[model samples]
Target chain A: MSKLASMLSTIMILFPGVAMATPDIIRQQLPQSVPHYWKWGSLFVNLQVNYFKVFFLVALLAIIIIEFLHFVIIGPKKFRESGKKIRVYNLFVRIVHWTAALSFTLLVPTGLIIVFSKFFGGDGFVRAMRSLHFIGAILFAISVVPLFFMWVLHMLPEEGDIRWFMVGGGYLTKKEVETGAGRFNPGQKIWFWIATVFGTLLFLTGFLMYLRKPNFVIPFVKYQIDALRLAAITHNLIAVIVLIMFLVHLYMSLFAVKGSLKSMITGYKDEEELKYMHSSFYEKIKHKLNE
Target chain B: MYKYSRMKFYCDENRCINCHGCEVACQVGNDLPVDIARRKVITFNEGIEGKEYSLSISCMHCTDAPCAQVCPVQCFYIREDGIVLHDKDKCIGCGYCLYACPFGAPQFPKDGAFGTRGVMDKCTMCAGGPAPTFSEKEKRLYGQNRIAEGKVPLCAAMCSTNALIVGDAEHVSQIIRERRMAHGHGVLDETPYGWDIAYPNE
Candidate 1:
């Protein structure tokens, strides 16, 4: 019985439809003959039909989910947080953040242009769309400069990070005690690292592709093409994760934590909330006042 | 643009002879790098004798161009004449275009001074490039946009069998219609060829 069960499981994985072929067994099983001269013409048409719609839907769904969650569920929650809630993200940071977002949005469409044009068909519209997409990529690189600087001062890891990652830093428990850390949290620091590495990979890969330089030291068009393919997959996967992180950030800033969004907009947080939420820094400042 | 009125390219498989003439003509005319073809001649069923026909595939420039819709910086533009082009300086070497293009047209050089070629090169429909008429930079990077100089693409012009055709939509369609009528109905089984061969290994 065990041997029979094992065989059944193997067949299930290797050929799921094979088990259901009892009815098909009696049906016509003749190999479909190719048209006399039709074989050459069917190659490009078949592949395009297979891949274009699948990838398009995956990308479209990811973007829509991220956007919907940010604007609808998370945006309002941070507006109602207690205590001081002003000035979390400065003007320069805000500018860079939005610019990065806009550039990323452009990258999606342009990327799609190259994919669909080859396998499916490139029309005049696809060509025009790609032009704008490349332009957006340039802007994404430009936006990085300002964003890089705004976070340069705050990215170093702190001792509290180890505890924060492990213990949820009182956020989960609602204990409302400030961990002895300054500036950003360990989670935010990790996000910075992800963005930095992935962004650099995208920039380097993108430029190489644009300049038409396919000669990797290994020397093959297929190699360069493969590398580019890997980069694209990585870029897309990372984008989905980052967008999800941004959704969390949006939730905390706008809806989860009341008055938190105000700090980003107006650049000031309430003193009482600061002391309650960030007691370590508050204590340092309050002590200095007593001195 | 709506679906029906959007511009498209249709390949005639019957006339192609596997000679790769279109591929070579495009490279020579555009000054594209060695081993870099903005357009390629692909054969689906080879070694079958008299059953093989080659298709020269490149960018199709779609109506609902997925690439344009996804660009974050809004860099794409639509010309009144329906030719699509871009600014190289404004391009970041992201491979998004590769994923989005269905025809696999855009190619990165991958062989330059820095061991990295950071710009994309592809067919500009012989419409020249993104510069003023006959500028050296446009000519150097994108080859001569001969269409702007009142010439059709050299590939189509040089087609030995006159298989490939290019021009305004109406003109090209009229030509194809005439060919079909001369050959009789169903004489050429309009099986869009490029898309099938483009992903053959998969």
Candidate 2:
């Protein structure tokens, strides 16, 4: 009897419906053929419960520590303000970039709070953070379209991209090195695509998760897919990638390249910076500057 | 002998008639919102001959409750009797519990902008929350503390066919064993539905 009971328990554990059948309605509602525990559900739970907070902390710490070391060792690139400022960004571009920046500023912190909700211990504060996250999503939705359209042309791959990567975009040395980079460096271009493309995916998955019961049906699929579970898994995975890239982008603009933040704020780039950081674009536009 | 008594809920598929009495009883007893369902009656192979069966499902209040494991705020607490309860005030309404729950027990009110989730509400097994027993605050937030009054959960109490039963884990299993034996089944072999997931150690 014990052997039989053990065998039955094993079967039930291995195949959920083998010992005591699951209701058809429950089956239809939460289709088991899709492998909820092994495939997606456990993965989502593990990522959310175990890894997300640590992942965010480690990523942030790694970036901060690495950037600190870089600043101490290699140092920030110092460029002489030649008093000749070129209007690199117009009013429209500045507005759009800041709008996206503000959204990211809101989104990233609130997202971290949500991940580390245990530390906050929930309540009105954490709840407020959740609401703030939604607000950030709305801001991102408004800014992302214009941000993409305005810079996509300049962000595309160019012959200079290879040279920029090979020389590490002159970031390793304090001395200025001519990197054949365009108006936007390869680093900037990569950040652009990740923010726009992966940001879109994040928004979509987040929306599905917000809905909680998307119940989306694929035409050819045999079993009903758990859309919310998939959304959650994809959202967390994409979030990690976006978060790391956002940090790098932040470090690059705010600290690594001195005066980079000022360029965005004042809508002007120093002539010296344009010469060394964007040598290829400087070559093309230098005549216009002289004229 | 067990060190501590574990409370559990069991729904007999053979006896359940799909009347949805438990669902209605729970809602009415708890004064639950229309959007929130603490208990649900699901039927298998409806309109089919010889293959039809029904059962009630809610928070299994698992020994290793997954919702508690996944809750970001650590609001969930399992009672000495193994009743899983959570502090509503501490919930941030993130809805992680919903994803982790195998039985889809967690329900959220659409209270936020764009129909985003409010705080989670689930079956408390009539044990209420961390609030003081029978306090007005407990009643206001978590509905009745029926367990504190030594009453069966409203769902089981009102189960028309006595299909849904709840009590000490040992007693529940004993009843199930007798029922199986009386039905000409010599020995209990198969685990009760959801037991493998909810109480794997049992």
Candidate 3:
């Protein structure tokens, strides 16, 4: 009888589903460490931390170095604003621009530190950077609303943009590229589009990772892990593009073009430069470009 | 040459009295923040007679540690003896480890503006981190290094019922097996949760 009992227990261990079925008392407390979805999500995290970070960081450094050398090689343009100032950017436009710019300025460094802090900092350092990044992400997401609404209509890509692209939008080649685009040039339109699309993506992904749970999974998405993983990968990829475009925009507005910074600051552009730079748009808004 | 024995910890639920002495001892020993509980005794069916059982949980310091694998900073390291240790200096507190750990061993103190995770804190298995052995910095960051002193961990040592056991994996299991034989039959989580994931031995 004892030998039969021992044999029965061994068989019971084999078909645990049939034999040692979950007792109610222990059901809720079984240590569920890793399920399939968690492991799948982990793959995305692996890619994000390893591939995206290394690749984008390299690209960021390369862009800064190349742009700096360009400045050294070809000293920025000396477009004298013809002394006839016209109101190109209204107060609303200026406000949105500064808000986006300031928020971006804070976001970039803090975001990078959050990613790379493990390489350099301790608990205290990471804590500080994480806090800063959270604030910056909120400001960034909020600023995008005004920025998109303000510039979306004006940034529609016109027919001339194709020609502008061929000539490198006057950014690549030293010679002038005649775009004759509307209020926003084709190059500017491209920047605006990239920023709008990828900027929104960054915000979404940033928040998903920030929330740290299942509160914001994509609707109708059966696979929560897939959606979250996609978010993680997409955010990293778009962040690289956003960083590049932001640098280019900053350089052009601040140094590459002489009157560009003044126009944004004062909400006015030199009438002569405006006409020469945005000839077609200049035609549409000339009358509106008040003295 | 054989390195140190594979370090491991086992908590017998049958012997546990739900005293929470392990949790309190760890917090006091580590000087961890109130919000951070390096060790927690999770009690199931608290008031229900005969169904009451508590599990003292913390980092298992797995052989194939997921935290070490997933850490972007590569902060976590596994000693030859299979004790997992992480460098605080290299931890970004991104909470990747928290998500990856099967035991939920990695913990983050809530600190950032959006309740953002602070640096990860977990059981060091009584072994200090990368800091010089027995140094004050290591003591402050990783709690006591009793293993280096040839002593049992405070959690197990302070267990009034001797429910928590910590030492070499082989020796600990042998002891448990002997007890099983002596007692005929009792509840046992035969495979330490996540043991295969940590130390595949494959």
Candidate 4:
């Protein structure tokens, strides 16, 4: 079969509900794509759009409120002495982190507008949103490349992660908790890995979704409709999960954890700040301080 | 008052030969760029005996068209005559309609890899879009607004086998019913898009 033949075959299979002339012959053949799986398709449509949107917004808001209160009640962690600063993050790392942050902030709103602003936005807004999304996607792709490589080694699951996770990464308890945290706690490690893995997946899926026309089906690349549908489903699902994690991440670093946001910005953390929160990391790097 | 007839397209599988006449005529009539086809014919059960069947699939122009429902730009409109039309100027070519549409009616000019492509182009059901009816601008963006000239679509008119039928849903339904009854099949009622979705009220 030709590439087009394969594509059309996939399309025909996806649309078995409409095709298949005789209603008498029961279609025992299962649909390959997620959308064509009987009521499963409609369920996905509702879940992917509505639940994803509601959950994302509600979780973000809830995280904000909780993090705000946590910050107020606990207050920022401060050492009595003017502590020496350790060069934890390099300048390049800070630049990449800010690039990721700025792109994400821009991306989230633009994505929400594109996905959820149907009832209100006109054609002009739609065009604008799409163009903006395309631009954001490029920046995001660039940021992801650097962030993935920069953080992958730092995010390796450590021996102390089990204790860190068991103690809820020192977040649940107000009493001084021995998290045995590295430069990043287990939670941050999880977020870093998820961000890289799922972020890469989103890019791949979004890339496939961007490709729309039938003419795109080259000989080597069998760009079938069913594959497109699958990619779209995965993209939406991954996006929702990633967004929730992102909100949680943003709150923890910026609002919940004191002095951490400054470290990300300045590539330096107070020596006492590191000793208090991340002793394991400080011990590892203390030998380098004398050099 | 809702006076205009509800329009529809019905394909009698029994008569269809999978000949690309309707497809060709539509492309020529529209002067559509090579990448896009406003109409197409698809076949199933190839090489298999008895089960081999084909259907001429294009925009059925549903009353509560999902294309209209899902369009981020709200580019589509259903005329009183039930023709589904879209404003090209408004379409950003995000290709949501292609995802939403069951018939796969929406086609874009650039169908290759990499970045964004051209604006969306799809079946206008012989009726031009939001641009002043029968105007040259409509013709330039969309193709001929032939429905305004009291003529059927070029594809339906050019179908040599008379397999692809286009008209008011009721009349077309009657023709299909009569044909089916003559062939000894029971009278199976057909709903023109919206009834299945909004059945009781519809």
Candidate 5:
């Protein structure tokens, strides 16, 4: 389509959001060259790259925290008590875990290549890096899709989990803390919700930024750009906050309260530890095991 | 030691015809894309009786540019000759410079289908791209940098009325002051000449 026609349509679509339709006003206020490109086209792509970087950064932190809790915080204590028989992650969880983990790691560096390409110019290596980055971002986005379902079954909060949150989940102080959190604590549930909401926003906003050809419409470009900027800010902020939370979660699971990592790692907790830490669930599972 | 001073752009309002000649001069000389102009004409009509004066606005290349101060990465740098330049590598595309510049100079390319061009492009005073000397990459990203080749900007040189003059700061300032003194307290002194004074409010 002709540039002017496309520009008119694009402006018409975004007209409701901003006062852009009055050509007289636009002519007066805008520089003659201002609309040479679409209203907010460049800003849109920038927001996309930034948002993904934020998402990957947060996911990486979450992985690190979950692993740390297993090895350092809860692992040693579990080993001392049960002598290394518990497994925190099952075989299926491990497969999904790694697929998502690898995808997340690949997304950041790849996405950065495209975002930073202007500085590097169109040099061969830079172009190659950006191409790879987009591929990695797609992989990461695809891998995250299944996590919602996996989490749907595991991350729901019960009344007991709410109580766990009320007492600060016994994370703040070391002694006199009782363990009553179920399959997932209220804290983990909250992170799951964040991952779902912000993660979806990041993916959809990111896809619009690509705006690849025949599939994407021109009029939505401005909207895509504005929404993308907001998504980027939200995505990055969540990533940073989530990273810190994951670190704390890791420490608690592996060593802080003891025997927590053993449950995920070996798929079992000492009978006594289970009785104290997850009495209600333990009783139910134990009764089933006996039957 | 390198000397530090404010960079400025001066326009002789009396000479401008509001023809937008300067705008075309800048775009063609710099090979800017279809819709971008490094220079522009702004017109104000008042006092009836068919009297209106047009002012051209672009990068003032200020001595204390707001773009430089607010940039988070400190990408902007002022040359010893008082020309402002920035490293595209360090730029984060935050658009803070747009808010800070008294005379809006920074220009960003439109992001199209071939992925977004994250780098910012602007008038380099006809000195070409970020790279040294004229090369294909620089030409593609920025227009020619003729000043580096010991040439005056095409826009200033092409001004039919000599309204735009690009040169050492003292010479241009002297020329404007002389024109104002010779013309006396008429439209030339007030219109495009003193337009910068009236610029902040509008």
Candidate 6:
């Protein structure tokens, strides 16, 4: 028996494939060039398991602190309720805007809860939050298409955009300066693109994640990549960018510029706000006011 | 002093015939849904003469389980004997555990609207759950609790070739070592297939 076993072992060693076939076959099947992003020691796992929660928490705190300090020191861009209102947003526009806003309100908190789930403790509450996250995704999906087409023309970069950026859209200082902005200020335009473009990417990646096993092949690649892992990495990265911009949008609408929130609600902007913040836009629209 | 023992499962690749008996046994014994497989048999190098081998895989119940780490609800818990388990009630079915798990051990039933996932399900090693051991609720939620009754897991028990073994880590390793020696193999340079990722410290 010992002699037979030794002979068998010698034969196995000489013909490795006979004894251990899987390793060589696996190597041949998978592309050697592309790194496996889903496994440990990769950037995707490290970010998801270690740093995502910290990054989100720090970003939230920084935005809140900075905005709070700005509010205290420079104060809001106060404008008198000039009794007369300009119809800046139509009813359809207001409806679409609020629908997107509602989605954000749901998505942001629930997404944060998911990221900080360890602290919150898993249960029905967090589970419900996850369900609500999906609901928010649905609402956003409904609103994004209309929201994009309705405002894309207005959101295009104008000659005055450079000047608006240079003067910081008259946001830094108390003194009212000529911002040379359009109907949608350069700041609002930036927020618009971020919300629409990055928001779409978020939805697509999120849909991929929702599928659980998105194993389709890429157009030019010979080897299949772990699509679920790639989606997760991309989703988290885009989420961070979108979160920061959303906070800025929230601050600008609710606090940074007084009466800005009213326009979305009532489909009208105060004449005083229109003149100072959107000076060039006011210059063009004032003729109609005079008429 | 009582010796510390961590329960683990070891699959002898050379011995596995890929008959899928383990998978069928687990499914039938647990009354699992058709879609949810607690254990599976994977055959590598299929149809290749003298180069084909098979492996039976499920949750390894790692010392530091990634599913436990990533679960938003802190639902997963490791028992004193190192059997990884989770509370079904606490699981929200967010699928984070699936992403974190290297073996794709976590399984979700599409029990929600628009195909949204319900709570997670996976191999329990037949140890049941936090529910009262051997009770109807425990059996319904987490299948059989053979471990509690001092019996081997159904899959391992049903393996015809004795390819799948489950027991204390030390005992499992001893069996593996004995098998290697009997086969005239020398000391292996590497650990078992997923041991490096699953039990880094060990």
Off by over 4 Å in 5: A1-103, A106-157, A166-178, A200-239, A246-287, B1-5, B11-20, B32-57, B64-75, B88-114, B129-142, B161-202
Question: Interface RMSD value for candidate 1, one decimal?
Answer: 15.5
Better candidate number, 2 or 4, judged by TM-score: 2
Per-residue lDDT of B71-128 in model 3, one digit per residue for the tens?
7677888888888888887777776676456555676655544565556788988888
Report the C-alpha lDDT of model 4 over B1-202, residue by residue, as the tens digit. 2533777787777888989889899888888886567887766666789977666767767666766776656777877877888877767676667655545577776522233655788888778778898788888878888888999989899988888888876788788888889988779655433234321232
How do the residues A144-226 of candidate 3 rate in per-residue lDDT, one tens digit apiece? 88899988888887876666666555666555545566677786887888877888878877765554433222575444334
Which docking class does model 2 fall in? acceptable
Q: How would the candidate models be sorted by TM-score, starting from the highest? A: 2, 6, 4, 3, 5, 1
In Å, candidate 4's interface RMSD is: 8.5
- After superposition, the stretches of candidate 4 with alpha carbons farther than 4 Å from their true spots are A1-44, A48-50, A71-81, A95-99, A119-124, A142-146, A162-179, A213-223, A257-259, A286-291, B1-5, B48-53, B73-75, B87-90, B111-114, B180-202
Each predicted complex: what DockQ? 0.06, 0.30, 0.19, 0.21, 0.12, 0.21
Fold similarity of candidate 1's chain A to the true chain A, as a TM-score: 0.56
Tens digit of per-residue lDDT, candidate 2, span B83-112: 899999999888888877777788887675
lDDT for predicted candidate 1 compared with the true structure? 0.56
Best by lDDT: 2
Q: Give the winner by TM-score.
A: 2
lDDT of 3: 0.71
lDDT of each: 0.56, 0.82, 0.71, 0.68, 0.55, 0.80
How many backbone clashes are present in model 5? 21
Interface root-mean-square deviation (Å) of every model: 15.5, 9.1, 11.4, 8.5, 10.0, 11.7
Candidate 6 residue-wise lDDT, B1-202, digit = tens? 1243888888988899889999999999999987687887776668899987888888989878877876656888999898999999778787777767667678877665455777899999999999998899999999999998999999999999999999988899888888888888966545876666677777
Evaluation by DockQ, superior candidate among 4 and 5: 4
Q: Tens-digit lDDT track for model 1 on A182-277?
A: 566666676676666676666765554443322223234223333444444554455545545554555565555576666666777776666655
For model 2, the superposed segments whose C-alpha errors exceed 4 Å read A1-28, A31-36, A215-225, B1-4
True lDDT of residue B101, candidate 2: 76
TM-score of chain B of 5: 0.80
**DockQ-based class of model 4:** incorrect
C-alpha lDDT of residue A132 in model 1:
68
After superposing candidate 3, which stretches have Cα over 4 Å from the reference?
A1-33, A69-80, A118-127, A208-235, A286-291, B1-4, B11-34, B40-57, B69-77, B89-92, B112-115, B128-141, B154-164, B173-191
